[model samples]
Target: MDLIGAYSDDGAPSPSRSGDGTAALAVVSAAPEVRCGTCHARHFPLSSCISNGIYASSQVDASGYALVESKLVSQEDTKFFQGANTRMIRYNLPADQMHAPVQGPTHPSGRKADGGLSNHRTGHVEDSHLSSYAFDEQYNSFHSDGVAMDPSRPVAISLGPGVGAPPTQPQQKRQRTQQSKVAPAPVDLTQPFTLRTRQPWAEKAAFPEQELTEEHRAYLEKEEKAEKDAGSGKGETSIFHGKALEDYQGRSWLEAPRDLRDDSATSFLPKKHLHTWSGHTKGVNAIRFFPSTGHLLLSAGLDGKVKMWDVHNQRKCLRTYLGHTKGVRDAWFSNDGRKFVTTGYDKVIRLWDSETGAVLGKYGEGKMAYTVRFHPDDDKQNMLMAGMADKKILQMDTDTGDVVQSYDYHLGAVNTVTFIDEGRRFVSTSDDKTIRVWEFGIPVQIKYIADPAMHAISAVSVTPNKKWWCGQSMDNKIVTYSATDRVKPNTKKTFAGHNVAGYACEVSFSPDSRYVTSGDGEGKLFMWDWKTKKIARTIKAHEGVCIGSAWHPLETSRVATCGWDGLIKYWD
Candidate 1:
């Protein structure tokens, strides 16, 4: 089965087919005609066609179909096929082959035309002019006429220099039409797809009934009332309305400054002052006041030194405790003010006698300890919770220095830990972008707060009165949460407007729970109106990262902050 040539209306082969078969060529026609030699079938209206002398002439039918055939030719064979060439040739004698001659008169009926086949040059069919209909017959077999085509014995036409060798087998063409890939039906995006054999499950678990008791409800109401009253003066401009406070970019605190500060007092005394007693060569990480006398302050620093300070005098290091092998990350005083605990990068928490600076006990083995805080109301029986760089929380018994429980709740290092209301519950924040509340007996998560900004929560503190809790984030915002039942638990209020990236290292509330104070990465101390969610006062508190802050337990007018600058600043 070989392709001789495509027939032209003028009975000549295309000029472009004269060169080597590999030369790129295009065939143009309104509707090219095709014939099959096998069945003497003719097909018409070819969409696209390529010619190769080695392959059979095949064309698409009216419905866009084509047939391809292949034959094994031997070098010894002379004639192309064993049969006579009559079947592959077409005669011009048939009226169907020609339209009326443009200007010629018809021959007299039954009489032979004067120009016989021998005398005619272009008008009559000669051996050279015979149309190869038999060759066209083999090309038409590729069509199916709206019927399924045989997959096993399919056909393809080979073009170019490789023509007439053998046609490639038809392949399953990729379904490129968009309609062919559509499903039988459309799916609804809003509906959950459920398998019939499976049971439906709740997406989120409900809060336990015990958590919403009458006592809890009453507390929430009281807290809510207090918060509302504090923000009521600003009406719709209030920022504490949602589960988390969002930035109101165009609105500046300066536009509403009076609403954030109390100008009633004539003295410049703050509600509390943090006296930094500096002896470490590096930044202080934690601070605690003596439980018996609020005048004594204890601080731990990255320089691996712990210092006790006398708040009454100029901020000076009164005593230094050296034991930890690495930087001290956290420090806390026992309830009786006679002892303190310090945790550090050395992976140990050491209990120390407050008066003599004696190492009482050592707990924690190989984990990098981040923070340590004592239970609020107990001296002998204290809860020491420490944050670990290994993404875990450890609760230890202060008396025995033994780990009581370990929590693997955070995905990243736990940065801060603080107890809520007498160590009955506690809150922890982490670089994993979540804050969690843990109750004493329950192992499961009680409340979880996620920040959409995904910033690490660097520090968390619960107010002394237990009315509110505040967390500082790496996103330069201070978030406040209400602890009382008068308001919704876990709701956050964000205070923005820090010129530099704020790493809220410490946060505390005034005794009245009216003002919130935070230390930033730049050693700036910002006091925010808890109710208004606006910055009340800004103090140049330190020269570097202000890592720790504490309020004067008795003096409600002063606060202190320690920083990387190896200095602690007192604000009033």
Candidate 2:
């Protein structure tokens, strides 16, 4: 008998007990429960089903299929039901009993509908009517053996139509077993092994004799001709015949380019002994070569002495000019090769007649004259520019030693001053971390290279062609700036090698403009290839800080370096 009842988690209003003294499975009457299509089962607790808008069935029909009522099932489940082939169906109850719309069951709307109960008579099941309570029912039939079976279950019958029993599951298949055999140990093919009866290595057949083909005979003839020609000195010239002996003999004396060595291998060999010259009693702060005479060099020392030397002859002190009371910091010769100028800590700039070793004039009254230079081309109206420790650059007339104009923009000490050409346009580097371009004829400042990180530009030198300007910073970095575009100067490269952070006290470009040389705080002199921006060579030029370096004006590969060690080195 079909029984309908409600089940709840609280156990209220339990189902009726059957004759077998067991309660029947609850079928919620107030609200239906939703069933899974594949499992054909519904969730219990009709209160939750009512809240969820689903219902369960009390009895199964002839089709052994049931409906689950709910509008709350997801839209994906709706599509699943529409395309499903399983023996499961969904139903919609009367509108007044449903909380949501009756979207399934496909019943006609209004009075024109002719299926199920009429909506007008029962006041229910109308598409336009809203629902407040609704339910669905699930169905399952019992097999003849009294076990429940799903209508969707597939059955295979063996006998007569409608009367035969269904086939049972087949027995499990058995697994095959493999037999194990003992394998012989591997044979040593390199040695000999007798397999069956006779030893194959002990018996051998004779090789047949064969005649050479025409092609093979021709190859042999060609080889004999080549051998004869080689012996007679007519075959392709031997690569090892003539210069090989000389090349082998010179191998021990030749020096290879550093880059030719493997980067991972040792490329540098330390010198066993160092060569030193100490004619100057005090720190030699500046040194420069005579433009036309490469063998002559000029040096300025802290003793207020400017000495000329024959650098090629064991560094013999040639001439000494003493006038300044303080240390002589810089010295440079004129382009005409007639005179040179020296600036000192006494704040005096002295012009000297080089041939007579005589002092000519003294200019500027400021103390701490750090650097001095003459105009590149003009001899009569020679311009002497000097930077002071008080952050001012004084331009003077070399002929009279009279101050002409002053650049007063640097906030700190002006360390170096350099001219680009003979056009009165020059550049200066200061302790303020700024390099400025100033035109002599104009009153306005032309350009300013301000980089906060580029601190203490101690020395500045411009290439002869004015393509680049290079300088050394107190941060132990060599910086090069492109002068190709004046409006926006760009730093082309930076070279770093010094161990201590301080200015490169002096710097100069080689006469060919192919190399640049600079002296740094650890008494090291460095040569850099201008084009590659790489350090080409380095030497410990002094025992103390090397404060000055200069290239011979006329000798492309010759250079001079001086330092606090009171020593000067001439390199070629």
Give the per-residue lDDT digits (tens) of candidate 2, residues 1-572.
Answer: 33433334575544444332123333333455555433366643332333334433333333433344533454323433443355653543333433332354444554333333444765544444423431111111123422332322333323334444422333112111111133334454455444622235332222234799999999899767744542333421111111222245464111221233122211222222223456678998777766655556777888877876654444566566766656777888887556888887666677777755555676765466788877766533487778888888887886566678888888898888777645457788888888888886454578987865667777777776677777777777777776554634556677667653664476677666777777777888777777687888888777888777776554345566778878876665
Where model 1 places Cα greater than 4 Å from the true spot, the runs are 1-278, 313-316, 451-454, 485-492, 499-504
Say which candidate scores most in TM-score. 1
Give candidate 2's whole-model lDDT: 0.61
Q: How much lDDT does each candidate structure score? A: 0.61, 0.61
Residue 348 displacement (Å), model 2: 1.7
- Compared with the true structure, the alpha-carbon lDDT of candidate 1 equals 0.61
- lDDT (C-alpha) at residue 436 in model 2: 84
- In TM-score terms, candidate 1 sits at 0.54
Candidate 2 vs. true structure, TM-score: 0.50
* lDDT tens digits, residue span 1-572, model 1: 01334444576544234554322222323345567543345533231233433233463343332222243444322232234334653322322122333235656673344334333545554343424673343444323222222222243443434344322344223443444465424333355663322135432222123558899899889766644532332111111111222236654211222223332322233644444455678877777766534566677888777877656544455567766656877787766776778887666777877655566677776677778777676542467777888988887886776778888878898888877755677788888888788886566667887747657777777766677777776777776667653223344577777633545477776656677777776767777776687788887777877666666665566677788888766666
Question: Least accurate stretch of 10 residues (summed lDDT) in model 1?
Answer: 233-242
